[model samples]
Target: MRRSRKGQPVTEIFKQLLCFFLHGTSRHLVFFDTLAKDAGYAAVIESESTSMLSSHSVKRFFRSFRWPRIYLFRHLLQRMFLWRLKLEAPDVVILGIDTMVMDNDEAKVRHGVRPTYKRVKGF
Candidate 1:
């Protein structure tokens, strides 16, 4: 299990693997399996995996944790991403924001799907 800077367990790093299969987006399982096998396709930055990552194990684990903490989790993710942006403020020439909506028609995806900026009274 991986951990955040605050030493909190980051289970979603694995759920990312779950979302690949359980969500029925694309041929996620085939893609995952193919990539897991072909060591030559691995990048220099990628350390070798000891064993293949199992989607079923992930599904079982996800059932235990996928509830009630999205508010906290999303904030934690945003804070980490913002911190990275501050540290690596690249040159303006190649800087851009790319918002990707994955393989779904998401017309009414969620309540906060639209971009909004609001000031809160307290930190």
Candidate 2:
């Protein structure tokens, strides 16, 4: 007998996430309504059904997710970057880690303006 409550396959869910990141609109929405309406996302996922990508489902996906998965994904991204550097034989590979900062629109950004080691004078 089928399970009491079946959910969408993991692969399908991941594909949806990937599509959203690649083609979603700039405007921020809790449920990513703009992302769901993306033409590229629709084609890649092989479905144009809004019900399949409902706001509740999207919110549930984020709510039920674990941090360890995100850590693992970050490691994978770094590994890919290193692999590409090796293949291309770059003279130097400078890795930059960025920290998220909350500030007003007047903030100025310049080359080497905000290094990881140096902290901003004013908060």
Candidate 3:
């Protein structure tokens, strides 16, 4: 599913995103600025140029994808997941997700803030 469009390939962008989540300090785009400066981390992406993509470039790349393309990517990911499961062939497949409560009580003006079960103000 490689596109002929110029610039970074889809796999490279996906690798950058994976690296971002694995090494990022915070769950924000600002972390990309720090990641871009790390030579050791840049090598992990295995790209021709040992340079990390900027947050702006990543944002632009995400914005460029339409709903249909995004759905197609999701389907591709699902297929990959199924293929990996087949290869692993585990006896018991237990799926779990961890959820965290973000506290935003310090904010002066809360737009979409709500009170969680913990009685904290956050999404």
Give candidate 3 regions above 4 Å deviation. 1-6, 43-50, 99-123
User: lDDT by residue for model 2 over 2-118, one digit each (tens)?
Assistant: 123566565666777666677655434344565566667576679655534655666776677568877887899999988988899978768798866544335664444443334
RMSD in Å for candidate 1, one decimal?
11.6
Instruction: Kindly list the per-residue Cα lDDT of model 1 for residues 4-110, writing each as its tens digit.
Output: 35322344335445545464646644565554565653332242443344445444444556445666778899999889888998665355887544433334444
| Residue-level lDDT for 58 in candidate 3 | 78
Cα error, residue 98 of model 1, in Å, equals 9.0
Give the Cα error of residue 37 in candidate 3, in Å: 2.8
What TM-score against the true fold does each predicted structure earn? Answer: 0.37, 0.50, 0.63
Best of the two (1, 2) by TM-score? 2
Q: Determine the backbone clash count of candidate 1.
A: 0
Clashing pairs in 3: none
Cα lDDT of model 2 overall?
A: 0.61
List model 3 lDDT by residue over 1-123, tens digit each: 335565577778888888678865679987777778877667666654444777887788778889999999899999999999999999999999998888889999889778985899976
Give per-candidate clash totals: 0, 0, 0
RMSD of each: 11.6, 7.5, 5.8
> Which lDDT value does model 3 have at 6?
53
